[model samples]
Target: MREQFPLQQEVTFELARDVGIRHPQVSGSFQVMSSNFLVNSFDPALPKFVLQAKYAKDLSDPRTVEKLELEQRYWEHKNVPWFLVTEKEISRTASQNIE
Candidate 1:
């Protein structure tokens, strides 16, 4: 399951679906909160990856850290991974420069 901002919801969902399809035995869903995807793999005892999307600029922001902490606690409660997907700084800066 996957969900980013309203603008990237579809794109992120597609990505999550692609990942899910690669693992036929896995089953999970996109959460409404911090986690974009919650995957439950075949190994029940292993820690699952908790995918989240964020912008490059937000990476060093205090709010981003807070959100990460919250996501960690939330996913950890259920024993999940705190994987984050952030835009590449170089690419983002290049794009900004182009503009």
Candidate 2:
């Protein structure tokens, strides 16, 4: 098995509502994508958006899900919130911790 995997385009942008911008009601999106790099270079007001996304089909495998989690933690450590957007409405629903 390889430690590094291919990069991807995985991002679905949502309307800010605070300001009208980009496409509205974007679909089949990911905060990030396959085969992408995290580049930090841009205006402060209009900072660059670093995207990171994986495919839903991968979730079927427990190993893939674990790998995704690892990636999520990596982004979080860098102070970036890795958001996921899926067409599956059920997946969109928040999980109940009930704690």
Candidate 3:
């Protein structure tokens, strides 16, 4: 079985609006998906996108590339924007950005 990570914190977000002479109506909400990551609103100033990351040593393998393509198609059908990434890319970027 795969090991699980410990929970460090929790946050909540609500998209709501008030109606005339009534309580606030919630249009939507966001929460941590599968307890692995936090969800946040996309910056309106930037282009809409979703980043899908995976850890794999074989960069030439079709599986890794296919997974990203599948995710891209799924999100596209839902009208959500997406981009593909990998674990190595994330680590490299983090290391470079560290002061």
TM-score per candidate: 0.47, 0.38, 0.41
- Give the CA lDDT, 0 to 100, for residue 30 in model 1: 46
lDDT of 3 by residue, 35-79 (tens): 122224557753344555455565577654543444444446445
Question: lDDT (0-100) at residue 96 of candidate 1?
Answer: 83
Model 2, TM vs. native: 0.38
Off by over 4 Å in 3: 1-39, 45-48, 55-57, 87-93, 96-99
lDDT per residue as tens, model 1, 2-35: 5442223344344445444221122575443346
Tens digits of per-residue lDDT, candidate 2, 42-87, equal 6675343344444667668765554455455445544654555333
Candidate 3 accuracy as TM-score = 0.41
Model 3 poorest ten-residue lDDT run? 11-20
Question: Model 3: which residue pairs collide?
Answer: none
Give per-residue lDDT, candidate 3, residue 55.
58
Off by over 4 Å in 2: 1-49, 85-99
The best candidate in terms of TM-score: 1
Q: Candidates ranked by lDDT, best first? A: 1, 2, 3
Q: Which lDDT values do the candidates have, in the order given?
A: 0.53, 0.41, 0.39
